[model samples]
Structure formats: structure tokens, C-alpha cells
Target chain A: MENLRLLFDAPILTVQLLLDGILIGAIFALAAYGMMLVWGVLNIINVAQGELVMLGGYVAFFLFKAGINPLFGVPVAAALLFVVGWLLYRVVIFRIVDKDLFISILATFGLSILIQQLAKVAFSPDVRTPQAGFGTISMFGGAVTVTWIKIISFAAALTTGGVLVWFLRGTRMGQAIRATAQNARAARVMGIDTDRVYAWTFGVNAAICGASGALVAMTYLVDPYIGLPYTIRSFMIVIVAGLGNISAVLATAIGLGAAENISAFLFGAEYQIAFVYGLLVVILISRRIVLARQRRYLA
Target chain B: MSTATGKMALALASAALLFLYGPTGATAQTEGDTINLGAAVSLTGKYSVNGKNTKDGYDLAIKRLNEMGGVKVGGKSYKLKIVYYDDESTPARGAQLAERLINQDGVKFLLGAYSSGLTKAIAPITEKYKVPHVEGNGAARELFTEGYKYLFGVLSTSDYYLRDAVNMAAEVAKENGRDPKSMKIAMAFENDPFSLDVRAGILEAAKKHGMKVLVDDKLPPEINDMAATLTKVKAVKPDLLLVSGHEKGATLLVRQTSEMKIDVPIVATTHCDSAKIAETMGKQAEGILCASQWDRTLAYKDKWFGSADDYAKTFQKEFNYPAPYQAAESTASVLVFADAFQRAGSLDPAKVRDAIAKTDVMTFYGPIKFDETGKNTKKPMVLYQVQGGDYKVVFPSKWAETKIKYPRKLPTN
Candidate 1:
């Protein structure tokens, strides 16, 4: 009650919370986009989505340690993760592609644990942040503080979203992927080489997550265990936006981010995660009720 | 041919039975001339870093003790060895591992885990089994209040960790001619046992000094950002900001406070050394007060590690990192165990427990004197201010190495 009144008393804090939320939401959107891509195209919910992001962050961290500016790590991390995604598809994802959704989920869940353990062994379970050296930009007479790295992350997320949209709409491979997502057997009959499309789609999703991970490493910090929260957040965002709805994903991500920050400010930081999971429960229940009213249970 | 096959099957079944039940049934707390201590530490989870430090502390002590002719018990020299199991930093796993260590491995003595939560989980099992458990890491006052006779600690309870910081803030406020009662505090503590205890301690101090609490937030364990809390701090403009969420909280608080340009007069937290804030964050970490159980510069000494500085040097040579207080206190825990073993002159858990309860010794970390509730009563928590890229003790006047820089200057980007 007191916190709510304080918000009204000094409205500038709302601006700070919203700005921080929106910036953080941008990175969340990027990760969610990758999740949506893989879920839509491959029909496999990649539980390992966060681990890929974690690996990308490690890539950026290592690059930073190697004396390279981490800002350049976005592209390098994306490129490297593309190969990792391709290899993962060829080795394990291929078998689960035609399997049950539950099977895919279990497989990816195991893969997530494996990746986290491997990263722990490889990188050491230290909370690491790459110094981006991009200082803060004071706004509204220093009432609101914004980090330059966060602004860059927001821009990078938008650019990546734009490039992803263009790739799907303008490129031939993108069309093949879209077609494969729609009707795999039909696309295969039309000479789409559906397997290659699946591989590329999965790779592209991972590359997107990788790019976002580099942004995360620069803006915040990363550790092996940090991946699960990202995975859960992206999952929530994707489910809310519905798979493959890029714009909705972006909007929902930002909204969720702002809501999280405002809720944390009002309810205390302990409720921040509770607010997220509570929102997820509410969304899921409301969707179910709406579907029931239509006399159709959700599949 | 059938008789021969049946005889071979019988032989195989007998061998398998022996393999399954032999070692467990015969296992003893002491094997020949060696005393076994069991520890379930976090080797693969969030607390892994501190867990590793705890393990290193135990290992170094055991190695040194064995080198110095081991513990003389019952007119016999016995080597000390620890059987370790990874608890994965979960309470359930810790409890299960504690059971396995006692029931299966037959470990009569137990050492502490990294965090208060893990120790809380394992303590009951030790108490039930009547095993003498001595720990240095678990400092939550709640642990001592449970009145577990077998549980002995070598470090001060969690509340003491930041009590001195609050007192110092009040003192500074009074010295500056400001009404200490008018000062406001903002606290952001992790929603865990240890940090919450620290919060309770600060709140008690604030209430006693008649200071107002502007903002009290509980940081989630996996928290990576503090924008909401900081935003509140900015709006309320509190005189002091107290944060405690272990290493992650320390790192984030130092990093974000600078980025946000928060101008709180005093910023104090726990786990700055464990987080390596002075070294990693450097200028941004300056002027932040840190609560620590021990520092290498303290003029504490014992037979095994000599002075605190000597123990730190030895630890660095072995582990290749400066010994944080987590490791230092852990080493102290082992020293307490060794002392108990010598005094008891036996491996009986009851005798050892009594010996531990009567412990009043000094080691490289600090003096270890357990009160009635199994918490160390002698050790005083030290406050370190990060000054010029180093941690300088600035509190508890008798042990103070330097004066505190008041109204901390935030680094200009």
C-alpha cells in the first residue's frame, strides 16, 4: 500500500522501472522468438533453449577474456551456435523430430541438463559479466538511468527480429521452412527437402538465442544455472504470444517485462518470480476457460 | 554337466551377496588408525564455489594435521580423512546424503556444508544419530535456537555479521551531528535463512537506534537485477542501503548502484570478498562495507597454520586464490574437531560431542568458544570497507586497521 502511494507521489520511479523493464523485455523477446521458431517449424519444444543462450553467453565471455570487445560477440556467438544447433539436430533432434511431443520435451530437457553440467565443468559455475564499457545515459534530469549496453541490446533485438521476418518472407529457404511447418509431408512432396528445412530452422532459432545471450552477458550477468529462468520466461512469452506470431511475441515480451518490474516494485522483489509464474497460471487458466466456452478443449 | 552348472550358479550368488552386504555391515567410524569425517557439500550447484572452498579448507587442515603426526587419541596416532558426497545444494539432497553418510558409510562425525540452509537440513540427522557435527559456515541464529546438543559451530551467528555495520552507521550519524534517530535505512536481502537473519539483525539495530526503514525488499535467490529495489532506494533517498544475497547479490548491487548512480551515504553488504568485488568490480566496489567472519590480516594464530596471514598464504599456494572467510572459517571448524578429538581421547560420538561443547580454543581464523546453543560466543564479526581496490578492516575499534571513509564517494564514469 505504501509503495503504491509512493509511485503516485513520485511518478519518475515508474518511468525508471518501465524503462528497465522494457529494455530487459527486449532481450527476453529475442530469446522467445528463437523458441517460437523452433516450436513452430520443428514441432519440437526445445527445453534446451536457455542452455543455448547460456553457451552463447559463455562464447561472448570467452571472447571478452580474449581481449575482444563483447559487442562484436553477438555475430560470432550467433555464427558459432548455428553450427552447434546443426550438430544437435543431426545427432539427437533428428530422431525426436518424428517422435511424440512428450518425447521431444523429455529429450530436450535431458539435453538442457547435460549442457548445464558441461558448461559448469567447462566454464566453472561463477557468475560472470563481460564489461561492455558502455556507461549509463541519464534521462529526465538523472531521474531515470539507462545503460548504453541495454539500449544496444534493445536495438539488436529489433534488428534480429527484422532480419528473421525478412528471412522468412523473402528467402527461399524461409519459404521452405514455413511450408514444412505447415504440412511436412506436403512440403516434402513438393521437393522442399523437409529434413534440411528442419535443420536450418533449428539452427536459425539457436543463432537467434545465441545473439540474445551475448546481449545478456553484456547487459547483465550469466551463469550455468541462469539458463533455466530464461527458458521458463521464453516459454511463458511464447505461450502467451502463440507460436510464430513474431509481433505479438515482441509485444508480450515487453509487456511481461514491464509488468514484472512494476509488480516487483510494488510487491517487493521476492514476489518478482511469483508474479511471473502467477501471470502464467492466470493466462493458462483464462485460455482454457475461453476454449471451454467455445465447446472445444485445448489440444 | 547339470550338477556342475548348478554348483557354478551357487558360487556366483554367494559372491554377489558378499559384495552387496559386506562393506556396509563392517564399516566403522574409525578404520584402523584413521578417523573418518563425513561431509555433504555443494559440489555442483549454486553454492559450488563456497562448497569448493569449504572442501579445500577441510582438505588442507587434514593434510596438515596428518603431517603433524595426526590426532593422538587413546595413546594412538590416527589420521583424519573425510568422505564427501555432493548434495547438489538442495536441502532434500543434503538430508538424503547425510543419512547415507551416517547409515551406509558409518561416519560418526560430520562437518558442515556451505550455506545455512544446507546445514539446517543436515543438522537434524546428525542430532538424531547422535553424531558430533562441528561446522563453520552455517551461521543462521535459528540453527542454534534449535538446541541441538551435538551441533557445535566455530563462527558467530548470522545476526552478528551485519550488527556492527548498523552500529557503525548510527555512530557515524551521531558523530556528524545528525540525529541518528532520523536516519533512514533501505534493505534488500535474499529470501533465505542466513540473509533473513542478517536482515533481522539490522532491523533490530535500526529499531534500537530509532531509525526508520524506508524500504525492505527480499531479493529472490536467482535475482540478476536490482532495478526495482534501487528505484525504491532512489525515491526514498535512504541514508543507508543494506544488501545481502550472497555473492550474486553483492556483484549485482555493486554493479547496478554505480550504473544507476545511486547516492546513498552508506552501502553495506555481505559476501563482497567471496564475490571478488574489490578485484573484479574495482572502482565501483570502493567504499562498500562488507561483513566478514575473518580476514587474513587479523593477528590470530595457532600451531597448525601459524598466523592468519600465514594460513592465507598457504591456502593461496594450494588453491591458487586468496582464502575468503568461508574457507578460513571452515579451516577453523576442522581445527575445532581436531582439538575435540585430542581432548576426548576417543572416537565415541557422545564423548566427542561433550568435548566440542566444552571447546574454547583459538585458531588462525578466530577464537572458537561455543555458548550453550552451539554458536560461537567469542568471535566478533569484522566489517571491511573496500578502499583503493582492497578490503580494509574499519570496524570494531580494537581490530580496526583503518578509519572508514564516510559518505562514500561514488565513482564518476
Candidate 2:
């Protein structure tokens, strides 16, 4: 009977769950967008994506420790990450840029381990939250509550996504990168420096990860081992949405978040990751079947 | 070619040097002047925080022992030295390190690693070698059921870790004019041995009291954001929200509770001050309660370490951080071994094991008496409530220092 009463209160609960899911999903979308940029242009799936996010979170934590607001630390981390990304490209990534997919995966996976170890040494394996000092606001007559930091992070993610979209559509470097991603041979024949584009594209993805990490530090907390989940989540999001489709990516991110939140509530939290990986397997097989059907008429 | 030759030569020289100095000198111990204690601790990785605390605890104990003229055994005094290895919180690595400590380091006395999983791995190695292992932290009762004669824990077993939390919840429920059977409690525990034991205990206790489990969930293995769990917790609106998410889960619960204002009457968790919740969360963690193995404010004391308060003050002076329960229990483990060593009056492992089997001494971390299963049977559980950035006892009528703000009101600031 009490459970039935909860069913009557479903509207308000749904609103709160959806709001929480969508906001957190925005952060996931930002991370997925970075994955899309690197995968579309460079044809490399960066397994170290989460490590970069973890690193950026450390940057935000340091800034927060220095008495800077975590909200303002976003761009600072992004800028720092851009430098790190560029350095990574010059040092290790550029060599593997034209390598086999498996080799690239191995290298980046190793890189993730190295970065995680370094962070463990530097930060000492503690879950630290960058204090937002922002309180909560009640919505729908106290049926729902939202933290101001989540709102700030959500807006930051949306604005960062919007700015990236605008930059891709409006800038020359972005056009060259898009051209390279669309047809590398043709772009190279057109005298475009595709190497430079690849470097900049990788750097931009890292910057995106750094910004997302800063936001995550405020909304959630940061840990050295917390990187792999972000990487796996971004990979799943990119696959579900299809690479380079910004709008689709955003929608899929929210969908994934909603699925996770709802599953956590319904099946309890233990099975939440199982549902996520299970969803990923289902999406891949179903998408393969759909593509197989699409090719049957031609065959 | 020359560079390769140079590198090979360097490697060969390093290997020879290692062989000469080797990791362990176990066989040399009888001839040597010092008693060696081998420790496989998680000095790095996720469990490092507690592991470090355990290390500091051992360090303080050893230093204090030396100050008191060390341990007298068989007509001679020998100072204690720990031959430590960093397990990085991996169970396989911890077991391997324990073996290495026995084989390479040749240490007879063993200190258990931090988490239950690591301790489980190390326990069998100690049993096989018949090395007397005195573990401080790993509280899961599962570690004892294997019936390793060589293994003993100074801290009480894990099922009892959260037993005090459950009893207090019922007490608080009754005080609030609510029936224990009518009250609902939600819980989320980490999927580790210690936490699983905690969950089992909480469930059994709740059943005894007839409290309905509103939400019982194991946190997802990898994801740190437990806001999803907290969201459900908000909707359920249970009388008490109990979590055994270890340190990370504890921090997340506190952060999310403050963020979402999930305002349950009581919020209890594992790793109260060990995770430094009061310092980290500040206002957010105020009034939160936890199942504590040892609180510094406890009046329990003995000859070596004085009172629990004295141990905390000394630990703070040395480590510059507040001593968590793990630290206190760790010091007690050392005291247990020393007491056994004194009674045996010998450096022989077998005799020392016999003495340890008959241990019935008191220390800063309660009494160190082990049952047949090698668990500390004398130490009692205490329920602690966070107040003004420190833990205050609120359970067990005798030790009730301050009243728990039942329903736990926040400061008006």
C-alpha cells in the first residue's frame, strides 16, 4: 500500500529523477563530444580520456584549494589541459597517430595506467571534492531539489558544447579538421596541413575533457581510479549517438544517464553498471542487425 | 651496442647488490639483535589512506617500545623493526608480498594489510608458514572461518562493525515515538568483504528489531558518483539511511546528502572520521553518525599507550593528522604482540604463537583477548555521532558523553 502511494507520487519523483539525470548527462555529453572529436578526426579511441578528466579535476581542486571558485576554474583547467594535450601529442600520440588501431589502443591504455599512477603519487588516492559552497534550491513546491553547483556545471557543459559547435562551423582550423575527417586523401591533395589539424583536434578534445573534469569535481568528487568509467561512458555515448553527430550525441548522453538513474532506482544500485554495459552490448548488436538489413536490399 | 652493454652491466650490478642486501633476513633473525615484523600494507592506491594510518600506528608503537627499553625475550632485549612492502591494495600483490616477506625478508612476525580482501590473501600465506600474524584492521569474520591457527586479529570482527549502528537506530527510533517494526531503513554497501559482512550484520540486526529495509543496494563497482543511489534514498524517505560504502561511499553519501538535502532523520555510515568527513564536508557532515571500532575519546586505557585520548594526542603530534580507529587498532596489534612476546619470554615463533593464543591484556584500543577463531572477543563496539567536527559517543548508556541530536538537526548558520 505504501509502495502504491509512491506510485501516486511518481510525477514529482519522475521530475526530480529526470532533472538529475539530464544534468549529470550533460557532463557525460561533454566528455563524449571530446571522444567524438578525436575518433572522427584522428581515428583513435583514446582510452586515457578519463585520465585526462581526472587530471583536469586535480587542476580544479588545486585552484579550489588556492581560494578560487570551482566555477571559474573550468577555463583555467581547460587551458592547462590544452597545453598538456599538445605536449602529449608531441611526445607519444603523434607517433601512434598513424599506427594500427590495436597498437593505438594498447599505447593509450598504457598511458592511462601511467597517468593514474602519477595521479596516485601526486594526489594520494583520496576522493576530494572541490567545494562549490553553493546551496540547494527547491523546485515544484519542494518535490524536487537541485544543487546550484549542478546547475553551474550543467550550464558550463552546455555552453562548452555550444562553443565547440560554433567553433567547428565558424573557424578555419575547424573546417580543415572536418575536411580531413570527411576525406583525408582529398584534404591532403587540397594542400591542407592534416598533421597540424590532427594535433589541434587532439588538443581540443583534451581541453574538452579538462573542462568536463572541473565541472565533475564540483558536482561529484575526483579519484585517481575514477577515470576508466568516464572513458567507458564516453565510448558508449559516442557509439550510441554515432560519431560526429553533436545533437544525437547530446540526446544519447541524456538517454544513457536516464537509463542509469532509472535502473539504479528500480534494480537497486548494484546492478546499475550491469545494465549500462548490457545496454551497450544490446545497442551494438541491434545496430549491427539494422545495418545488415539496410545492406540486404543492395545485395 | 655500448649503451646496451652499459645498461646490462648496471642491471647486473643492481641485482647483485639486491642479493647481497636482499629484502628479508628472516634466517638471520635468531642471530640478529632486533625482532623483525613484516608488513604488507597498501601504502599506495585506493586503500592507501587507511594503510598509511595503519603504518603510522605501527610506527608509533615501535618507537614507544624502543623508548621503554624494547621487548625482553630469553634474557636479552630486542628492538622491533618492521620490514614493510607496499601492496598497492591488490590482493594478489599483497599475498605475493607476504610470501616475499617470508622467503626473501624472512620475517616471522606479520602485520595484516588494510582491506579484508588483502588480509584474506595474506592470511593463508601466514598459515602455510605458521607465522604468527597479528592483523589490526581487516575485520571481516570471513577471514577467521578458514581456521588459520597462526592468524589473529586485534580488532573485533566485521559483522559487529555495524551492529552498534543498527542497535542505535532502533534506540533512536523508539525515542522518536516510532515502533521499530514500523520504521524503515535504507542501505547501500560497497561490494567488498568488509562491507558485505556489514550488510549481513545490518540485515540480521534489522530483522531482530523488525525494521523494514526500504532500499538495500550494493554500490556499482567502479562509478564514484552515488547520486543515483541517493536519489532513490530521497524518494524512499526512510527513518535512517545507512551506508557501508567504505571511505569513498561515505564521502559521496555525505556530499550528495548535503547537495540534495535528502533529510533523513539519521544518516549512518562506515569509516566515520577515518575518511576525514568532518574536515572535508564541514557543515555537510555535521551530525552524521557511524559505526566506530575505536574512538579516541573512549576511556579505555592501559600501561603502554595510556588512555585512548593520550594515544590520539601522541598520534596527532607525530603524524600531524587525527588518528583514525585504524591507527588505534594498529597500535593495539603491536601491543598484543609485545604482550605475547613478554609472556613467552622467547623469540621462538611457536612459543610466541602460544603466548598470543593466551592474550588477555588491555590497551588503548580496548582489550586484546582472542577467541578460538582468532578474533578479538573482548573489545566492544561503539556508536559515534559527529558533532562540531569531532566524534562524540552517543550509544551505550554508560559511555554516553553527549546526547545524539535524534533526527540530527543542522546548525542554523
Candidate 3:
């Protein structure tokens, strides 16, 4: 009898979970886009990508404290993060651009720890959310309920993605960035300043992270330790979607989000992280095997 | 595998491992004007918030002790001093710092680290070194099951966190002429020791009180989202929503619950009394219930901080925020140390350990009585409702200030 009730209730629950996953997955996609841009252009796996998101969250946090509407925190956080990203590149990324790939990973990992500690000192360790007070709207006679802030965050992510695509396709700097990303030596030979392009790409990446962080601050709770998970999720999304594939990245992230939500439901929340990493491992291994088979056939 | 060469190689590996992580030598004992209490506080990492609060609690206790004519031991009056280092919220770092404090600093007495994980790490060091560690924050039941005589916990074990809340909710249900057996609960918690212990207690209490558990979910370790679980909650519409996911989980649950409008009769959680939840959620915080180990509204008093209300006022005046239960328990840990030191009448570690083992007294925080497991078994957990801006105790009528506002009314604007 109990089983029958649960079985009957499964449909509405599934619909609600699906909506929640896509909305949250949109945020994941936005944060992952930032990761993809930096990775594609710089060829450096930024272990501290999540820290930038954390810093962005802090920007929104302070702005909200200063009595600005938390919604306005989105753009303000972006602009501030742009400056931060530029500074980080000039000081750290510039010097280590030509170092061994392993060296960059280790350095960025250390940078991640440094960022977490700094946020702890600056913001204190209390968990905080800026409470946009957007309220909620029920759907399907309360079978599904959607928070307004989540909707706004999802819409903002789409708009940001749209703007980024337009800028990349139309602007000269975007073309230069693309050229540098494709062939840095050829772009430099063509009189394009590769160094400036790299810095701008990193800065824009940071700005994207900042905007994502503000939305997160409104939608989810922010803590100093929340960074590394975001970094890992973005990395997973990029890997699953492939580098420099923005539209695919967005689609894959939503898919991953829905999958995660469903898994969280079926397997319980304790296994959610393990499930994600497990999925990443499985995907990578299968991709490797497929490539090996393709290489044999080609030979 | 058991050949002579293999044995020799195994011995060499063991030696190398020991050399890498073995205990260092303790400096010569120096009895001076101050008694140094070493602590590996998580001051610079994930546990930094509670760590800072714990440190402030220690600092306040030490300051008050000095002002009131410090600990008198064996015809000598000595001031209390804390020698603390940031553990960075890592178990390994906490253990390493504990070793350094015990060996390099020659500090035999110890204070607890912030979270249960850190405390678990630091406990073994105290046991090996024969140091008396009085920890106020770490309350996981696993900490005491090791049977370490030298370690003591000042706070009640996490098993009692929701015991009172479940019982009171059952009682409140009876008062409203609702069937206790018909009352359903939705439980979600992080898969950590503290929260797991809380989950265990809620399950037991619910079973004992004849309440049906509609949903029991263990939140993911990183805890990024609660939407899926809250969605299930909305589907079931349980009469009570019980959660025990520490600070971050608690705040997220409250915010999302209000946003989703999963209007249960009660929204009781383990950490809602925290300023993080109360201050962040503001008006949405009203009517939420929290299972608190100690509340300022409780009718308790002591010579040091006077009543619970006085402690709140004094703590706010000094620290610029109302002291949470962590701070209160940390302060009580210090007081327990002081009480033991006075009773022991000497600075000897063994004597202090024995004195602490036999402690049966009361303070502003609660009664300080330890069972054989070194846990304060006498302290009863209290239930507090987030009424306006305060965590008002609303259970066990003797300690309660106001009757529990039955059937938590969600604000509809």
C-alpha cells in the first residue's frame, strides 16, 4: 500500500525535480563557460576558477550590505571581477604561461587554497545568501513550485551566454581572441598583441564567473569552501561538452544537472558528488577506448 | 612474503613511516605565572566561523577568570592563558598542531577544536600524550566511543540535539487535538558524523512517539542544492520538516523552504538558532523551530555570567554579536577546567584529569556532570523557536519563556 502511494506520486516529483535541475544547471553552464574560455585560450587548467566565483560572490555580498538591490549586484560583480581577473593574470598567469603544464596546475591549486583562506579572513566564515526576496510562483496547482530568483538567474545566464556569442562573432577583439586561441604564434606574426588578448580573455572569464557568483549568492548559500566544487563542476561540464563549444557546454550542463538531481533523488544526497566524479571517470575512460579503437581502424 | 629479506624491508618501511609522522620530544616542564591551555582552533578555513566564536569564548572565559582572581592551585594563584594555532579545518592539520602543542610547546592541557572531525583528530594525540583535553564543540558520539579517559566533551553529544524537539512537537500535536501517530516528518541531513548522530536521534524519537517518517534523505557532502529534496517535501506535505545539516545546510533549507512554500506545521532544524539563519532569513525566520543544546532564554545562572540572559548581553557587549551555543559550551569548557584545577589543588595533569572525571556542578551553560565516557550526560537539550529576532526557548515549560506558537504560520504577502 505504501509502495503504491509512492509509485503514484512519482510523476509530479519527477517534473519538479526536472525543473529544479535545469534551472540550477543553467547556472552551472554559465560558470562552465568561463572555465571553457580560459582553458581553450590559455591551455591552463585553472584550479582556482571556483575561487573567482567566490570572490564574485563576496562583491555581491558587500554591495548588498551597502543597500544596493541584490539584482544590481550581477553587473557590478562582473565589472569588479574583470579587474580582479586582469590583475591575477598580470601577476601570476603571465609569469607562468610558458611553464610546464603540471607546474601551472600545482600553482593554481595553491592559489585556490590562498583564495579560500583570504575569503575566510575578509568575509568571515558565516554562511550567507543575499535574499533577493523574489518570492515563489506555484505551477501545476502546487505540484511544482519555482522560486523567482532561480528563474531570474536562469534568464540572466541565457542573456549572458547570448551576449558572449554575439561579441565573439562580431567584434575585432573577439576575432583577435579567437585568432590567438587558434594559433597564438600566427596571430602574433599578424601584428595582433597576443599578450593583451590573453589578459582580456582571462579578464572576461573572471567577469563571467563574478556574474555567476552573484546569481549564486542570491540563489544558493555562499561559504568559503563552496569554491572547489564549482571548479570541479565547471571542469566536468567542459570535459563532457568539449573545449570551446559554448552551446554544447550549455546543453551538457543542463543534462548533467538533470542527471545529478535524479541521482540525488534515487541514490540519496550523500552519493551525489561521488556520482558526478564517477560519471566523469566513466566518460573519460569510454572516450579513451573509443579513440584507441578509431586509431587502430585508421592505421 | 615472510622471508627474512621481506621482514627486513618491512621493518625499514615502518621505521621510515614512523620517522615521517612520529611524535617529537616534549620540552622541559616550566611552571610559571600562567597556565597555558593549547588549542588547534580552525581559524583560517571552512570551520573558521565557529572556530573564531570558540576562540572568543575561550578568551572571554580566561579574561573573566583573571579579573575574578585567577585559578588558585596549591596555595598559588595563576592566570589562564591559551596557546592556539589555526588548524585550517583539516583533520591532519588539527592532529599535527595537537602534537606540536603537546611536544614543542610542552602544553599538557588542551581545548577542543571546532568541528567533530578536528576533535576526532586531536583526541588521539591527547590520549597518547596523557594530556587532559576538554573540548566544548565536537559532539559526535564517535568521539567518546573510543573510551579515552583523558578527553572530555563539554557539549552534549549530538544524539540529544533533536530528541527534545521531536518530543515537544509530539506534545504540541496532542494539544492541538491532532493524532500523534498521524504526524509525519521529513528529515534531511548532511552525511557527516554530527548530522548523522542528529539523524539517528530524530529517527529514534519519531519511532518512540509514533510519528511516520515520510522522507529521510542524506544531503550530499558538498551540499550545493536542496531543490530536489524540497520538491519531494512539497509532494508529501509532511506535518513536520526536520533537518540537521550544520550551518550551511540549515540556512539553505530555511531559505528554500520559504521560497518553495512547503508549508509544514513546523520547520524544526538543528542549527536554526544560529545567527546565520536568523539574520539572513529575517522575517522568513519567524516561527521556525531549532533544537538547541543551550538557549539564552533558559532559566539557568552561574556566578561568572550570571543568568543566560546576562551572558547574552555581556557577550554581545564584548563580541558585537550574540553568543551561539558553541561559544557558551566553549566558555563552560573553560569553567570546567577552572573548577577542576581548583579541586585538584595542584598543576599535575593526572590530578586534573581525575578532578574533571568527577565533576558534578552547574554553570551558566548547563550542569557540568560527566559520565564514564567523559560526555556531559546531565545536560538536557532545549528547543527554541525563532520568534522575531530571538531564539526563544519553548519547551520543558520550566525553561521556556513563551508557549510554542503551534502550527508555524508562513507569512503570505
Candidate maximizing lDDT? 1
Candidate 3 docking quality: incorrect, acceptable, medium or high: acceptable
Q: Tell me the lDDT of model 2 at A97.
A: 81
Consecutive 10-residue window with the lowest summed lDDT within model 3 chain B: B22-31
Task: Quote the lDDT for B217 in model 1.
Answer: 95
lDDT of 3 by residue, B1-413 (tens): 66998999999999998775554333223346788888989889778889999999999899999999998988889888899899999999999999999877778799999988899989999999899999999988899889999999978899888877888888888888988898888989888777889888888999998999988888876786887788777777898888888888788877877777778888888776554577767877778888777878788888888998898888899999988888999999999999999999877888899999999877888888999999998888887788886677887667789988878888552
Candidate 3: clashing pairs of residues: none
TM-score head-to-head 1 vs 3, winner: 1
Interface C-alpha root-mean-square deviation, candidates in order:
0.8, 2.1, 2.0
Q: Write the per-residue lDDT of candidate 2 for residues B1-413, one digit (tens) a residue.
A: 69999999999999999886675443454436788888989999889889999999999999999899999987888888999999999999999999988877778889888978899899999999889999988888888898899999988788887776777878877877878898888888988877888888888899899988988888865757777677677778788888888778888888878777788888888886667888877878888887778777777888987988999999999999988888988888888888998899876788899999999997988877899999987777877788888778986545567888778764322
TM-score between candidate 1 chain A and the true chain A: 0.96
lDDT of 1: 0.90
**Model 1 pairs in collision:** none
lDDT score for residue B3 of model 3:
96
TM-scores for every candidate against the unseen true structure: 0.83, 0.84, 0.80
- Native-referenced TM-scores of chain A, all candidate models: 0.96, 0.95, 0.95
lDDT of 3 by residue, A158-270 (tens): 99999899878899989998998899999999999989998999899999999999999888878888898889999999998998788998898888888888777767677
